[model samples]
Target: AQSVTQLDSHVSVSEGTPVLLRCNYSSSYSPSLFWYVQHPNKGLQLLLKYTSAATLVKGINGFEAEFKKSETSFHLTKPSAHMSDAAEYFCVVNPGTYKYIFGTGTRLKVLA
Candidate 1:
């Protein structure tokens, strides 16, 4: 079937290091992909997205991702992760360019 898979359910990192949260997806259509960050007790915020126009996309808080059709992946990456980056991140896909179907979830841990 069609779905998004975040390779790691959780990622731990030091406060001032790079962060890598892997996400891979598959769809019959050219999909709409997104990364959303949710802080504790807060709603989801759009971090970045790939809408087929651009392969490399960037979003808030110095995060970016590349849409690779060959690899069937769109992984979230950030240089020098902040202490505030300790939050859950979700990989979302829209098969019809409508609303999103999100992955289960990915929890991020920031260690001082």
Candidate 2:
């Protein structure tokens, strides 16, 4: 079984500052991990994904994540925060199946 846990329920960052959203996973084997962001009343948007490729995965809107098998972590990061970046983020794990295990989610608040 694979599962994902978002370390933070909420995160606040000032505009133009760096942003970090931590995520950890539990899996028996190499698992596919993903980061998705959902704005208010909007659907989930793919930020980045790791699927046995490069350890450093880049995604849209200046976001990226590093897949660390040793630590069982795939934390998302951005050089700077933007107001538009404020949203609910989800970490997902795929255990080589159609089903996906999602984290509780982290709500980002970008302060102006």
Candidate 3:
């Protein structure tokens, strides 16, 4: 079985500041990890993904995450925050099947 957890349910940051959204996963085998962002009433957009390729994966809008097998973590980070960046983020783990395990979700609030 595979599961994902988002450490924080909500994250607040000032515009132009750094952003960090933590995520952890438990999997029986090497798993495919992904980050997705969703604006209000909008569909999810793929941020980045790690598929046993690189430990560090970069995604759109200056977001990136590092896969740490030892720690069972894949925390997402951004150099700077933007107002448009405020959204709900999800960490997902694919167990190599049609089903995907998703984190509860993290809502990011960007303040000016």
Assess each prediction's global lDDT (C-alpha) against the native. 0.92, 0.95, 0.95
Off by over 4 Å in 1: 97-99
lDDT of 1 at 18: 94
Off by over 4 Å in 3: none
TM-score of each: 0.95, 0.98, 0.97
Give the per-residue lDDT of model 3 (tens digit) for 25-108. 999988999999999999999999999998999999899999999999999999999999999999999978887899999999
RMSD of 1: 1.0
* Candidates 1 and 3, the one with greater TM-score: 3
**Candidate with more favorable, higher lDDT: 1 or 3:** 3
**Pairs of residues clashing in candidate 1:** none
The TM-score-based order of candidates, best leading, equals 2, 3, 1
**1-112: candidate 2 lDDT, tens digit per residue:** 6788999999999999999999999998779999999999999989999999899999999999999999999999999999999999999999788889999999999999
lDDT of 1 at 106: 93
